[model samples]
Target: MEILRVKEILNEKGWRNKDLADKIGTSENSVSAIVTGKKFPKPETLVKIADVLDIDIRELFNPSKSVDLQEIFTKDENGNLKSVGFIKK
Candidate 1:
């Protein structure tokens, strides 16, 4: 799930990960992890990131309609692919 739009916003602002990291007093690796969704940021960190980017925190998330459930899938016992939205009764 490509939730965060940090990387895109960074590109738009002509800023690098290190630039944001320095502004927020964190390591570039930490920012990269957040940008890549490898690390879920703490609320404070998220606020700092939003502040640095001059965007509302809500802008960091993808709209619900924009999230593709098919992208989040897993295999079943029979090796059948199952989307996260699949329901079994």
Candidate 2:
């Protein structure tokens, strides 16, 4: 999720961060965090976000990519997985 995308969506809907915060019962800072990906909202928050944006949750998390199992379960020397390859059986 890109901040630019969210900004575009908001602009298209003629909504401001403060307006969305009021509608969702959250603070402008929280909304900003979500838009910037500094924080991921919970399920309920996501619901509110979707409602405010008039978009489906599925749209928020578009699933068009192929599954990559290795990305789901692998780690490097630093204990941080590169998460790039498909699953190796």
Candidate 3:
């Protein structure tokens, strides 16, 4: 489960979803899902988003929510697959 205040951060920074989408080379709909907590981005995408937003990647995570680390990745931050409504595919 995700708990990042992505939308809030975007608002605080005055960034539209289109801005994020453009920065990441993805569609606005994909960015919207992540912003709304309807989906999680791929790790690489997450890194890109964090960079674009000028935030730590950890800032996008919900520290209070505990998702199994094993279920999240196969190798490392840049590796294999684990998805839930990940729209950028």
Candidate 4:
């Protein structure tokens, strides 16, 4: 599955593959492979990537789901908690 958000973040930073490669001390081909998802970056490399991009490592991956923190859950009579829906904070 496509998990990494490298390409999207790179676009936001207005950076080319070469720029990232240089900053991370890797080759452009290596960066390209990571960007295309043909290869996954090692943990150390991921740290370097995050540092170069000036973002948290968690931000490098796509969020599996979007959750609204404003949604409050309460237990029903049956004792099952369920989302009542979103509410303004």
Candidate 5:
């Protein structure tokens, strides 16, 4: 889905996962997992990714599925999106 788009963006920018991770202050593995769809980025981190890649967040939405952008990014009472089941190391 959007993983393809991310890869395309990276290629277009002559960058790689490590480059993206470095630019956004995240681990390369995190970015790799994200690109491979093995994990999802935190909503805030996703925003950073969109900014780094110079794309709209909507562009990252997977078109093949029923992606509820609002629900996925909805803030909790603590003002943080609920965990997407992975943790930052």
Candidate 6:
């Protein structure tokens, strides 16, 4: 993940690490680690960061390749195909 991109966004928004940490309910050190690529945040934390930045979660973890809907459904551990969302053509 290009965590520096997040830092750049914060800088552009005139926000400090502490400000972001407070907004995301995390510590400044944790935010620093994330920004420096020393750690990865949990999904919930990623969502929180995206919400605070007014960006989509996909912007943070941009998938490099197209997802195969059929593969995803076929790999379902529970074999519950109905649980899968719409398959992209």
lDDT of each: 0.88, 0.75, 0.81, 0.93, 0.78, 0.79
Q: Give the candidates in order of lDDT, highest first.
A: 4, 1, 3, 6, 5, 2
Better of 2 and 4 by lDDT: 4
Residue 14 C-alpha lDDT in model 5: 93
What is candidate 1's local distance difference test score?
0.88
Estimate the lDDT of model 6: 0.79
Q: How does model 4 score by TM-score?
A: 0.75
lDDT of 2 by residue, 1-89 (tens): 35235656778788898998999999999989877778878989888788878898666664466564544547788998666556644
lDDT, residue 31, candidate 3: 92
Model 6, backbone clash pairs (residues 3+ apart or across chains), number: 0
Q: Give the clashing residue pairs of candidate 3, or none.
A: none
Per-candidate TM equals: 0.70, 0.60, 0.65, 0.75, 0.62, 0.63
lDDT of 1 by residue, 1-89 (tens): 68889988999999999999999999999999988889989999989999989999999887767433334578999999887764333
TM-score, ranked from best to worst: 4, 1, 3, 6, 5, 2
lDDT by residue (tens digit), candidate 5, 50-87: 99888998787656655434323457888987745533
Q: Compute the lDDT for candidate 2.
A: 0.75
- Which candidate leads the pack in TM-score? 4
The per-candidate count of clashes, in order, stands at 0, 0, 0, 0, 0, 0
